[model samples]
Target: MKEIPKKNGFTTPPGYFEGLSERVLNKLEEKDTSALPSKEGFKIPEGYFDGLEEKIQDKTLQRETKVFTLKPFRPFLYAAAAIAVLVVLIIGLEKNNTSTPTFDDLAQAEITQYIESRDLELSSYELAEVLPVSELEIGDFMESSVDQDEILDYLEDSIDDLDELNIETHEEYQ
Candidate 1:
């Protein structure tokens, strides 16, 4: 076949195609328009490729969001961790409280020693004056009181008897 001169983009031979025999031209036209085997071997499902592309784009967006969203909660996480550590230390130390003496317990022990001592001179001035009171008078009134055992009991019993006997009767009611 003679080569064709290109006009615009077609590379057909100029008068050669025009002078082509009818049967050859017809056969050439038929072959040109005939469909080749479909490219179905490499084909994917219709919307699968588009969905995959969308999924990729969504994953990229999610990654970007995660990268940018981390800063604000970092301080809170650190504070919570610090608080947890402090709580653990406090709980560990609190477990040993029974071994440690509280101020109130020490005071109570000291007061008891002062109260039970033989020598009144060794007692505090406050306890020394009240030491002469008898044990029987100390029990009924100050049974539950820790600090003042003797004088408080005597005074409390006296006050209760006085309160019971001093009741006033209204003349109108009588």
Candidate 2:
């Protein structure tokens, strides 16, 4: 039981395949055609050929009495189940979504939910990789409403806070 044997036990003598064709051909050549069975050991039932028409008529002429049974509406049941799954999926996809949240009404909880739900297409890190919002050139806003003097005055007022924050300033490269 411990040591399993690898041998198959069945083996052929040496030169088995070498003369196989010649041996088979010799046996076939030695066969006596006259000694072969004439009826091939088969027999037809008595009166089988004589009553062929009657037997065929008995099967063909009679009504089959089919009850028009369905296999318990199995295919239709599967189709209905599939349609129900599709309907549920469609309804769920439709109802799960909501309208965009308005900025004025937007709270910290809504922002957190939006982030957690992955509703925002890009994260803040991805947005930073694109043009930073500060570097954007908005010609419409710059030409009309923006006042350089007012901006300078605001910056002068909060110069102390800017220094306190230790923010790095960009050096002009010319």
Candidate 3:
């Protein structure tokens, strides 16, 4: 068995490439010299170029301009904002106005217990000073339900000598 050598099957004649470029140029020149019109039937109308700039400007100016505004919705927006504020205020007031206990609502025993538990260092004079003088009346103190015997007993137990007591009478005021 013999091995065949690989060879290109296509071949060109001698000097084919050397004359290729010259042949192509000659064909182009022949086409150029033929009796065909250069414009190939496409023609621009007269005065078309003269008015092109003005025509473009006129077309641009004739286009309607788009305008956007919030003017129509201004009142609605303001109303919505005001409604939001009112709603917020209403909710806030509802929360704040919930039934909070006032000093008058507390029982006397509860008030006394609270004062005793806190061990406040304030004296009776200091407590009296804090009370508004305008609100106090002689009946407020005199109207207490304590028995006169109990008062005498408490005073006797608290005081060693009656001579030290500075009792004031209504006659002394005159």
TM-score of each: 0.19, 0.23, 0.30
Where in model 3 is the C-alpha error above 4 Å? 1-21, 29-41, 61-80, 96-174
| Superior by TM-score: candidate 1 or candidate 3 | 3
Tell me which residue pairs clash in candidate 3: none
The list of candidate 2 runs beyond 4 A from truth reads 1-4, 46-174
**How many clashes (backbone atoms < 3 Å, residues ≥3 apart in a chain or on different chains) does model 3 have?**
0
lDDT of each: 0.65, 0.72, 0.78
Best by lDDT: 3
Between 1 and 2, whose TM-score is larger?
A: 2
Best prediction by TM-score:
3
**1-174: candidate 2 lDDT, tens digit per residue:** 588789888999998999899998898789976786666687788978997998899888968687887657468888999999999999998887666557758764676577779866886788568634684566623556756566555776868665675645445311
Global lDDT of model 2: 0.72
True-vs-predicted CA distance for residue 84, candidate 1, Å = 2.1
Q: Number of clashing pairs, model 2?
A: 0
lDDT score, candidate 1, position 174: 30
Cα displacement (angstroms), candidate 1, residue 77, comes to 3.4
